[model samples]
Target: MSDIVLLNKHQKKALVIELYNQGKTRRQIAETVHMSFKDMADIINEYTGEDKQVNKPEKSKDSRAFELFLQGKQSVEVAIELDMPADKVEELHVQYWRLSKLDNLEILYHEAEYSLSLLLRLHNILKDKRITKDKDISDLIELANWFTRS
Candidate 1:
């Protein structure tokens, strides 16, 4: 617990990868990493050579969207550039962000980019323990309050 609490983002990912390599179940790894099980499963699936995205008719569009996302383009920008529907691009954006492992970093960037203390608080939340779905929502709501108040 103390070990994980002190680890930075890359260390956490490396730990998750290490756990996966050692044949830990997705649920086990997620608990160890304090991440949501679904997010953990997605990371594991991608790491284990399973295609997270499949059977979409717009395969090339997804690929292009991934490229655009990698270039740091937001979803709206990608949608416009690719002439894609907003809803579809929105879905793709979530997938892309998860696939790219930009989860907490993106949130931190948008929510507290200039505030080291806020960033640390967000970091502490993930670092401390596995958060349940409802608890996660509560923490996010609290964080949003902090953002809005500033």
Candidate 2:
């Protein structure tokens, strides 16, 4: 099995352009990146500044359903529009919601890591100061404890 590469929007666009430049067909690149052909073409056009006609393929039903849901369409409405089961529309909505939550959590995790590094640097800078003796830095200790417990 091939390992999945997780990329943010900018990175994904860059990758798509790079792959396209390397002579990969749009269909090939789209399938490789798991993006709709229309979306891939749009990215390429945005990057290259060419008014390319986007191929409106019918293969991105899940994405279309999710797009409708995000546009304030209910599950039943999306199902009717997409000619899919309401349950399937609901399932796709839930899946997209979970993925978004995971993305947010990943961002929070990176922020927490950055904060810890900053805290450590600050602690090192203040290590030689007599202020450490006056102030217990109890919050830092508590943070360390929490990390260890987790």
Candidate 3:
């Protein structure tokens, strides 16, 4: 019998990648990580290939939204510029830009940006570790909470 360890998202991904490289079965890795078989299969499917359709979102939409946000445009301005509704822009802002429960809205954006960079670093590292799937979502949330704490 193996011990069940509560891993953060980064750690889970790292473990998966390492196990994959060692030629472990997805089922075995799932068992080791205390995940469901279905989740293990999904993770293997997502991270194991270069031409993975599940991995890529539309580039232009992501890039344009990011670019507009970076240019210091207000969500309303962004909406007009991008020909999207203001409400939709607001949705994007809330989704992509973190909204703080305390302090000014602008500060929240800056904080979110910094935190996002940290998450991105972890994400890339995990990618190198070859983690796939949204299976380890709990761990990911845990990691994100850790990011906020730090």
Q: For candidate 1, what is the lDDT?
A: 0.80
Tell me the tens digit of each residue's lDDT in model 3 across 1-150. 776568987788778878988999877898788777766666666687645566677666546876788777787777777888776776677655553233355465467765877767877977886765676656777899999999
lDDT of 2 by residue, 27-68 (tens): 889888888888898898888888554455565999888688
Full-model lDDT, candidate 2: 0.78
Best by lDDT: 1
List ranges where model 3 is wrong by over 4 Å. Answer: 1-4, 50-150
* Candidate 2 TM-score to native: 0.32
Q: Which pairs clash (backbone N, Cα, C closer than 3 Å) in model 1?
A: none
Two-way lDDT contest, 1 vs 3, winner: 1
lDDT at residue 69 of model 1 (Cα atoms): 90
Ranked by TM-score, top first: 1, 2, 3
> Candidate 1 lDDT, tens digit per residue, 1-150?
354356677787788889999989877888788888777777677787888566446659889999999999988899899999998997788777778897976565557657968767766886676654777869878998999999
Better of 1 and 2 by lDDT: 1
Candidates 2 and 3, the one with greater TM-score: 2
